[model samples]
Target: METCLCPLTRSFRPDFVLIRQHAFGMAENEDFRHLVIGMQYAGLPSVNSLESIYNFCDKPWVFAQMVTIFKTLGGEKFPLIEQTYYPNHREMVGGRLGL
Candidate 1:
């Protein structure tokens, strides 16, 4: 935190800030929001701004929005995603999964 503030108070300030904290709850999210707000107050741009982070964390349908954006941005031809659980002896042999 001090490291982030030192540069802000000095003559050189970052043009943009990228906040990549894992905020789980209101308290954590608010903390991150305040950080982003502080950066904006310092006349800087912030990636994943407070509002965006809130929507992303709180909204249940955010993934659908991302999928829409992906398709809109020419990702419609992308392959479908498949998830498989581990410890399946049928798929694993000799400690290696059949890929």
Candidate 2:
């Protein structure tokens, strides 16, 4: 049997929810999306709403801001290296799409 990426069929429903997702990349999967959708369908109050997480993950500049915040907040100081990491996402996409 093929496993469904997002399983909406839940045996139990919860009254409250607290979503402490450290990494937004996890939301890229349809399974996570479906789980969030299911939670919403059940009318549960999530601390960090799935929509908010999705929005944060979808924005490319968020990571750049995070890097800035990290450096400002004593994350690390590297010599002879750029403080922020802005990947060439366009190049990556072009390579993948053969553009």
Candidate 3:
């Protein structure tokens, strides 16, 4: 069976690295757009929700992967919090889209 690459897999050391590496490889490949579209077709969100979960929980490894993935996808800067809002918009967006 094919394994699902989600944030929960970070609990497993080797598997987490493997998943991150696989994602990085996909991000670097020429056919990455097709790959991402395929993943979306398979119900994987454009952004990985697991990464947001890890960020909220302050898991270093997962956070690092999130940063890397964000940058790889052309998000140059990290998102910032806005005090005017109650719930964090970034988190909300990430959660809503399952990213």
Candidate 4:
């Protein structure tokens, strides 16, 4: 059952909603991810869960989590997590070539 992926419509009614997969910025799901999240908050059940979806959506965070888990399970006493985390995400977003 194919449906429009933009503008977050409430025209469809299903027994349970399973919003499993969606690309963050693609045209097919540019604004659709937000709808799934809203629906999830508004008492809809979603498969593959928003938590799982967001894991892969954030690559650096995935790396951080995986490294922590690996260090925990493998008993490696190296510094897996650093205390000094940059607190300015908005400050990094600019037109300059800071990349």
Q: Which of the numbered candidates is closest to the native, going by highest TM-score?
A: 4
lDDT of 1 by residue, 44-65 (tens): 7767675575455543345556
Clashes of each: 0, 0, 2, 0
lDDT by residue (1-99, candidate 2, tens digit) is: 988899587587677888776334644553365667777777788778766655565444555555566667654552223333335677565544210
Could you give me the TM-score of model 3 versus the true structure?
0.20
Per-model CA lDDT versus the true structure:
0.54, 0.58, 0.42, 0.58
Error of 4 at 69 (Å): 1.1
TM-score of each: 0.35, 0.41, 0.20, 0.49
Off by over 4 Å in 3: 1-58, 76-99
Candidate 3 lDDT score at position 28 = 40
- Give the clashing pairs for model 1: none
Q: What is the C-alpha local distance difference test score of candidate 3?
A: 0.42
lDDT of 3 by residue, 1-42 (tens): 999886663332122221232323323452333444444456
Compared with the true structure, what per-residue lDDT tens digits does model 4 show for residues 1-99? 898778965676665665545536546646555665666677766655766664566556666676677667763644454432333665456433221
Residue 59 lDDT, candidate 1, scale 0-100:
37
